[model samples]
Target: MTAPNPSTHDQAARLVEAVNEALTPATSYRDASLLPAVGPTPPVPQPGRPPMSQRATDASALMLTAGLATAPPGLIAIGLLVASGYADPLVIGMICAAPAVIAVPVLAVARLLRGAQGIGAEHHHHYNGPVSQHTVHTETKTRGLFAKTINKQ
Candidate 1:
């Protein structure tokens, strides 16, 4: 077997040294002192009021569920009656109009009750200290499944 070339031996030695340098654990400090000091804890957030009252939300949910539960069967019954020539035009018209007839007065009464409860009415605030007021307005635009919110200060 021929002796290994001097240049090839030197190259192998340099490659081994490079690999050892890479594999060796670093000696530099990796303690918390190398990181930023922790600052004071942030203030807890306050809770906001819901868009609708519990009673109203419950009532609306109940109405929606009742409508969903009854509508399909009711429609099928009406269709069968009309097909069998047993349904009168006036009765059919009244049945179709029932939702509007029931909804109008209910909505009006709800609006009046909401007004009595002072919701959406402006209030006068009296501040007794040096006050700094910062107002933020947010607008949301939604199209299909995507929504984007923009904030103006």
Candidate 2:
């Protein structure tokens, strides 16, 4: 997919031009727009990334916030479970979600607190752009262990 060579880039650019040329006929476009009954003028299409990135960031922040707020519920559940006579719903939920509960304080004190600093900016009047960096998180599962890293060369 990486067209490093000049010849391939020229070909790709030519192909796009050809496709765009074929898509619009002067008469066809003019005829459609000539109708005075149409509503306000249509907005122009701008070239850039779609708005999905903002939405994705919002969703991630929301999920993480929800997870951080449920710190004490998990601890209480585990405590009640261990003190129960035989069986209980609280105990079962506690056992299943124990890991998540234990991680709440760490998540708040470390990651949440760190990320909060970036949320505010009096100097950033125009745009607070994304900070790009290359990183990798490796994990070992039943399938196997893997080292995932970015190679930008």
* CA RMSD of each candidate after superposition: 18.1, 25.6
Evaluate all candidate structures by whole-model CA lDDT and list the values in order.
0.85, 0.72
lDDT of 1 by residue, 96-127 (tens): 89989999999999999877855457878899
lDDT by residue (tens digit), candidate 2, 1-153: 864999988999999999998887766433455656778888576786444578897887899999987868866766776678565867577677887988888888898677775644555435468766656665534343665544434
After TM-score superposition, the amount by which residue 117's alpha carbon in candidate 2 deviates from its true location, in angstroms, is 46
TM-scores for candidates 1 onward, in order: 0.33, 0.23
Clashing pairs for model 1 are none
Error of 2 at 128 (Å): 62
